[model samples]
Target chain A: MARVIAREGQERRVDGIGQGDHLCLVYADDAEQRRVVTAYVRAGLSRGERVLYFADARAPREVLGWLRAEGVDPSTALTTGQLSVTTAAVGYLAFGAFDAHAVAQTLQAEVSDALSAGFTGLRVSGEMSWALRDVPGADQLGTYETAVNAVFAGQPASAICQYDARRFSAAALDDTQRRHPGTVELAPLHLNSRLRVTPSFRCGQRMLRVQGTVDHHTIAAFAATLETVLGWPGDVWVDLGELEFIDLAGLRALAQTAARLPAGRRMHLVELAPLLCQVVNLAEFDDISSLTVTARDAA
Target chain B: MTDPAGPRLPSSRRLTHQALIYGSDEEFLAATVPFCLDGVDQGDSLLVITTAGNTDLLREALRDAVNKVEFLASEEWYGTPGSALGACHRVVDQQVAVGEHRRMRVIGEPLWHGRDAVETAEWTRYESAINLAFAACPAWMICPYDTRLVPEAVIADARRTHPELAVGASTRSSPDYVDPAATTGFWERRIAPLPADGDGDAAVLDFDADLAAVRVFVARTAAALGVSPDGVGRLVFSVNEIATNALQHGGAGRLTMRLAGRRLVCDVANPSRRATDWFLGYRPPGPGQERGYGLWAVRQLCRLVEIDTSDGVTTVRLHVDLD
Candidate 1:
């Protein structure tokens, strides 16, 4: 009976996700996908829920391997029928088509079967790229996603719809994002009313993406995030493409982080707004050898 | 008097602020051309901020030596007293860091033709402040005041502001000179009050401990007044800094915003009656210094920033010109 709704401009943590929550995860790359999938599967299995994954971009064995790497033993669950991993072709595009009502019925049946089998409920995750294969009625993916909300409503069932940002068109991503009530984001290093600092690892690079304002009210969060990111191995990159504002205190936090970086490791600031670029330059942050700033052209 | 090497003004390792009063083109060139050439001879980095006419005259008079000096028009350089102070500090700091120059010599002529009473007073305060703001840097600045074009009252104020007065080839200590520490308090005591919000059209917000709401109020209000996106960004930044200070230092505050002609004015007032420093934001913080940057940045971002404390309330007024 747990329902989670992510407010606009906010994201929900994967661990805090509950039954009756319909979440969409737009992953930047394979590393990010593996991390979230492992956490989601582990969370479900620990709670005795029947965990299901419909893998499209990754093989079923590869998905299980991620669970094993994250210290979750999927073998017992797989053997006991408490966990299932299949291709999206078999699970979603069954019978050569995707119909919204049919998918809703299929999801409801799974939830019912899990309860009858003595498991707590059902937790499902599907890699959504298979819909792009031109299968019959595949264009109804949005309809299916929206319809499944009712299938999970007041029921012990939840879902995570995964879309790879690299392959999906902007319109598709936007359409899918609006159909879900929540989004699965990694547990942020920091979050407050005015700012969100979410961390991600892609292509072996640690990154922190900042969104919203970083001023006196939010400098503590921003500074703390920078401190956490700096503690990680290798160089760090902060993506500020969605950042609406950052003040002197925020800049000071960045400077302090850059200064604290060990020799040979640099803090890379990418997609900085033009106004912020002016502020950084005025602060003379360029003097910090460990820091590099690149301004994204104004849209 | 036509030594071509300029008057041998006192050369101090510390800052030397002088007023060069000239009545005619001959006198202006006679003082400035020699000042530039002499600074160049002494390996000092030279910057000349003056009227377009004076820039041309100095350029012609210096001939080959003019290339060694950086020239900026006064209208563009003197955007506000705070900004002008920031600009001068940058020039001096850059020169000092390069180690290629012994000192920085500037010919700064403030724009005074179209200023109101408040602006005139602020500019006069700026002249006084240069004495303290650059007291540590090896900068020798000459503020040129044209007797015919500048108001007689402003010309009189200049004598009191500048520690040294230069007329043609003669240089002498100005008996009218007042120390910045003394004048700063005097100016603050006599600081002009903002015009009455007579129309009741001004947007007002009472804020306490909510810096974010303060920012939103300023941004929306400035945009409603037709401030450009960039202008709105700057206004929000400036106002947010002041409001944050108000909340932290004064416990709470109120904000009033109104448009005066094409310029947007925002005043943040708090009940804390502590004496505010008139020169708080003039000097930039040193490298790696954490505090004191908020106010400095506010001055840099806004068109004009005035701090007034009177009648049991302290107010920080910020102005931004709308596009």
Candidate 2:
């Protein structure tokens, strides 16, 4: 917020607050909340601003339908689905809400997306239409701004910058280093919370493109994406140079991925994970090796 | 009782043929598939037994050195000679039937273990073993180093020991001992050639697994396929793995192979299972790695890997290109 204000020389309100690029709001409600929030967003739509909406899967369709009728294409808005609390938050960074409504049944939960859903302090600091309810830590002074900045800056792939211990678990991170070669690391601050996430579209040389641990949890997504990317009906580099852990599940996923590719597409593994290399040999996967991954030089 | 394992029922087909020997041991391995190799052939139901289960030595001689034995279990015969003979007899009887294409081959280096092994009275037992094997043996050949030590009287008393095989030990050559009286099948050669060359079936091969023997077996097959022996030794050892598995599991299974197109396609099917991933031919790390290493070895050496398992049928095929 400060960078945006400083760089743009935006005016600060006399109420001891800085003007910000984005605005958000939170409120505690009992009922009749929908009418109020929809009105707020309708105001923005009437102003002819392209509004983006973000909400849980079962959010009220009427509010979104109203926005769509006003002209925002539904596809442009992203869905975080039911990702973890932190992931949902990072998604929010990209998927900032217009007049979105996310209502959880229980406010406090064992594993709820509440930690990353705070919008409590933006009302006085900036001017924007915000109508959220019982945001976990909404009353904090500048906490909301800082959380928003995290996603705006430190762009970890797929991970929404909130907090997580796995980000810098000495053992897991160290293990990653042992197998992978790299120096500069923006490690997680703790077990569950990341330092911050500020995503950039820039594909930088300093980017440590990591090969993720391929397990049942991620195999389908991994393979389908690989296949889709390869089947782009045009040229695309499905770079897998930095993948680390690949178990049997991962191997099968890769095999399935290669099998699904259009024949003679020239797929290459380009420095495949150790176990994947073995799968290639045993299953005669090389029969379509040109269309999948190929081992690349170890740098 | 008599050793029931010898060529019993003479082949109604009445096929007569000469021994076909290739120049190299590997050539013999490739050209010598069960049911037919060069001038020899075994029927579909072929049982193989080998007392010498030295996998290392067999690898050196067998064509599918590792891939052949990759997925099956293999072990040396630890039971008594009599029981081993009994086992052989049972295998023969179980497979060989009247008008059935049953053939069994038993190969081992002959050793005078004790009086129990080569006693003159044991001739009946030896004859029974051969009779049982040959009863179903479409065409059988045994490569025992010396049966000469066993007295002629012992062999004579046996049910079907080649009575006229000059009844003596190593006086001349270690002549191959065969009895056509056991499951003889006539091939009308020029008149009635083979069944169009590609009647493929699952097969199992169990042989005395000596590394040298393994090498000998592999070299025979390689030479038959006419592939230049440049770095093919690895392929040879790879195929041996399947053979080792057959030996350890099937007790006796034939190495059934056919020359399909440019490929010397062979399979060593066994009634055993080794569920390990060995796509890279290296020393398998498990207990069965010796033969379990076959899958990995096969993947490395062959052009294709086709494994079909259904009901009780398991076949592992490795195609070695002749060109």
Best by lDDT: 1
Q: Which 10 consecutive positions of candidate 2 chain A have the poorest summed lDDT?
A: A1-10
Second chain alone, TM-score for each candidate: 0.90, 0.31
Q: How well is each residue in A1-299 modelled by candidate 1, as lDDT tens digits? A: 11111123335788888888888887765777887888889999999999989999899999999988888888899999999999998898886788778878988999999999999999999999998888898988888988998977678999999988667775687677778886777656777767888875332245677888888778876787787866666677787887877877887788789889988888888887777777776666767888888878667
Model 2 residue B21 CA deviation in Å: 17
A1-299 per-residue lDDT for model 2 (tens digits): 00100011121111222212222221112122233334444443333322233333214364456446656544333242211112223233223432122211111121123224331111111111122234443333133433343332222111111111212232322222232111112321111121121110001111112244443234445544454344333222333444434433344445555556566544334455443464455433454444445555444
State the lDDT at B152 in candidate 2. 45
> Judged by DockQ cut-offs, is candidate 2 incorrect, acceptable, medium or high?
incorrect
Candidate 2 lDDT score at position A293: 50
- Alpha carbon lDDT of residue A225, candidate 1? 72
Q: Per-model C-alpha lDDT, please?
A: 0.81, 0.35
